[model samples]
Target chain A: AQKVTQAQTEISVVEKEDVTLDCVYETRDTTYYLFWYKQPPSGELVFLIRRNSFDEQNEISGRYSWNFQKSTSSFNFTITASQVVDSAVYFCALSGEVVFGAGTILRVKS
Target chain B: DARVTQTPRHKVTEMGQEVTMRCQPILGHNTVFWYRQTMMQGLELLAYFRNRAPLDDSGMPKDRFSAEMPDATLATLKIQPSEPRDSAVYFCASGSGTDQGGYTFGSGTRLTVV
Candidate 1:
């Protein structure tokens, strides 16, 4: 069985604050993929990033960054200097019939 | 641009009524996925199709829920005798079914069974 866990149900932060959303997953397959998606109030899911299990290299794209650590089975997302537009529900998922986490609701305030 | 399309955007129906949701995957995409999202469940995969064939639907309720891909371009999910507990936002996503073929999601159909 594959499972993804997002421990934080909700987080409220002020603009310019750096926030980290924790994600942990379990899977038996050595070759698998992990993903992060953002769903705003508009109800559309926006793809953020996709990381293969073999690559543990931390990635940075603009103000959004991801830290994938195989040791902890964790793939955490961090937003540096988050803006109000970043407020959304973020989901972490494991691929191969894609299993999703419970998601973390992020509220960025001005 | 290429994107998955779904309808109706929102549906409110009485309990025991049959509800059907539709999806049109991106052209040339080989895989289609149906998901249900709610406050409690987050997002759950109900079923999926590959090359217009049903792959896995273990997540769906066999008795009340049915999913089908009548053609390569179209997919449908039907819930017979829906109950209030069945209310949720149903999403349709399409992919190439490969590691790099990240899924592209539709806006989703918000269903309210009262």
Candidate 2:
């Protein structure tokens, strides 16, 4: 069985500050998928980014970016100048069969 | 935009009562998943189905919990004789069976077993 580990239980940063959430996963499959999801207070899980195992390239979308390193078994997410809206619980998932991390709670203060 | 739809966004029921939550997967999506979320447990996959056929449900509590997809679009999760421990948000997600990248999640049903 695959497992996802997010060591960070909570993160707090003032608005306009950058934040990074670390995620590590263990899986036997060489080819799988990784994902980041955001869940706001509204109770909806929003998709943030997805990276395939074969794709090692770091991806950037606006103020959000993800680094996928197969060697360290890590897929980290970074938010640049995060806003209050960015405050939420972020989940990192490994999708050979869709295993999710314990999730990191982020609070962006104004 | 295509999105997974879940009904009864909020449900408050007494313990020992039956609770049923419904999910409508996005059109053309062949895979559906049920998940339960709580502060302690975080997120757990309860059941997974493809093309209206159950593939795995080991995460579900066999005695009081049941999941089924009677058709391609509809999926239901029922908990019989619910306990206060069952109070949590239940989410349903769907994605293309061929796509392993991501799954679209519904707004989830918040169940409060009092």
DockQ of each: 0.75, 0.82
**Model 2 agreement with the true structure over B1-112: per-residue lDDT tens digits:** 9999998999999999999999999999988999999989999999999888999999999999999998887999999989999999999999987876489999999999
Stretches of candidate 2 off by over 4 Å are none
C-alpha lDDT of residue B25 in model 2 = 96
Per-residue CA lDDT of model 1 for B1-114, tens digit only, reads: 888999999999999999999999999888899999988877999998888899999999999999999888899999998999999999999988754557999999999999
Clashing pairs in 2: none
Candidate 1 interface RMSD (Å): 1.0
Candidate 1 docking band: medium
Model 1 / residue A28 / CA error / Å: 0.3
| Per-candidate local distance difference test | 0.94, 0.94
